[model samples]
Target: MRLLLVEDNLSLADSLTRALNQCGFAVDCMHNGADADQVLRTEDYALVILDLGLPKLDGLEVLRRLRQRRNKVPVLILTAHGSIDERVKGLDLGADDYLTKPCDLTELEARARALIRRSHGFDSAELTFGPLSYDSVSRVFSLPAGPLSLTPREHAVLEVLLMRGGKAVSKDALSEKIFGLDESSSPDAIEIYVHRLRKKLDGSGVAIVTLRGLGYLLETRDAAA
Candidate 1:
């Protein structure tokens, strides 16, 4: 999943980015809240890790504007303010979850995974489509035979498709989720990953179908039949 991390603390941001990436999240970090606010408005993210203390624009204001625009992307507030009033205010402003600074990495990752799962309307960590099952927490994909071996890019593409279920995911969306905002990857890069994934998933009961200009959809062979 792709997540935006809005934090000015370079050390914390670096650590969180590495940890989240290891946890199977493609993270884009922005130190300035103004930039983050604009990115949130323009980009599609699975979740946002927002820090209340920001440089140009306050994180609370960013949250307020995002809510005012009716953007429902899940947000988890990471701040040093540990007061009940502050927590209440953040929640009121549309934060899905709140975590104070100096938090354990494990706890933060757990909260992130929980929020992402909930945002996707999944009650559990395991997502299944036909014989394919993915454990979101462990970032593992499995079939009836055994665990599926997929390159990181292929796995990321498959995750996005599975998250959308039967819906078509555009190439632009896939590129954004896979390469993130900082990378300079073409839409053709997405096609390469999709082609590789299709070859690997052949005869797996699930197929990734291209809809021409409409993009790609993951469907069961039986459904297509």
Candidate 2:
């Protein structure tokens, strides 16, 4: 999954970006709220980690514009100001969650994961499709036979597919989610990962089907028939 980290504090932004990347998230960072706001309007993100004290534009105004335009991407506000009014104001402006500065890394990651799950309408970290099961927290993919070992890229691809349920996911969408906004990736790279996943899941009763011009969809072999 990809996340936008809009924070001006260099040290904190660097640390958070590194940690989020280690946790299997593709992260893009912006220091100014204006740039962040524009990026949010143009790109897709699993979530946004926004700091209130941003340059150029206030974070609250950016969020307000996002909500006014009806962009429902989950936003987690990060601020040093922990006043009740500040928290309530952010919520009123459509922030999905809020975290005070000097927060624990583990707790922040957990909260981000929870927000992503909720945004996708999933109440739990486990997502199951046919005989395939994935635990988001453990980053484990399993079949009826056993747990399936996957490369990082393969896991990222499968995460997008499973999260979309049975719906088709476009190549561009998958690319952005897996590669992040700043990374340059070819469609062939995504194909290689998908091909590898297909092999690993060959006899697992689940299949990744390409829809030619449309995209790819995960389907059970029986359902395909």
Candidate 3:
């Protein structure tokens, strides 16, 4: 799934970015709340990880503005302050969950999965589309023919298509959801990744359908004789 991580600590941010990427998530990271707010406003994301102590704008204000705009994207508030009032304030402002500083990465990942599942109304741990299945916890993709190894980018793209199946996701939307501004990656870069992914899934009876000027949709192709 796609995620926005708003944390200011350079070391922590880098480590979290690398870890989340390895877990088959297309993570767009921002070090300031201002940039985080901008991304949240402009793009669609499955979840957001926000730090309370952020530069430019506080995370609470960011959350408030997001709610003010009627954006219901799941948000997990991460803060050094782990008190009753702080938690209450974040929850009142519409954060889905909260994690204190010095938290366990595995635990944080678990919470993220739970929030995502709850948002999608999925009670199970796996995300499935036709014959392809993805284990969000294990970060593995399974298919009937042979399991395909998916990079984070590939996984992210597929997740979007699976979530909004039959809808054409524009290239601009896909790039924003996957690469984000932190990488300085471009739409052309997204095209290249999608091309490679198409090749990998070719002849497998699973199609990433190109919609000409629109973008892409994933669907199952009828079996050939």
Model 2 lDDT-worst window of ten: 216-225
What's the CA error at residue 84 for candidate 1, in Å?
0.4
Candidate 3 per-residue lDDT, tens place, 1-225, comes to 778999999899999988987766778889998998998888888899999999999999999999999999999998898999989999999999999999998999899988987787666788777777767777667777877877668877877776674578888888877765557777777787788888888777777888899998888876461
Clashing residue pair totals per candidate (backbone < 3 A): 0, 0, 0
Clashes of 2: 0
TM-score against native, each model? 0.95, 0.96, 0.85
**What lDDT is obtained when candidate 3 is compared to the true structure?**
0.84
Model 3 error, position 12 (Å)? 3.0
In angstroms, the error of model 1 at 49 is 0.1
Give residue 10's lDDT in candidate 1 (0 to 100).
97
lDDT of 2 by residue, 113-200 (tens): 9999889888988889999998989889999889999988999999889888889998888998888767888867888999999999
Query: Which 10-residue span in candidate 3 carries the lowest summed lDDT?
Result: 158-167
lDDT of 1 by residue, 1-225 (tens): 899999999999999999989887889999999999889888989999999999999999999999999999999999998899989999999999999998999999999988987887888999998878999878888877788899888999999899887899999888887777777789889888989988877887888999988899888885334
Candidate achieving higher TM-score, 1 or 3 = 1
> Model 1 — TM-score against the truth?
0.95
> What's the distance in Å from true for residue 67, model 3?
0.8
Ranking by TM-score: 2, 1, 3
**Candidate order (lDDT):** 2, 1, 3
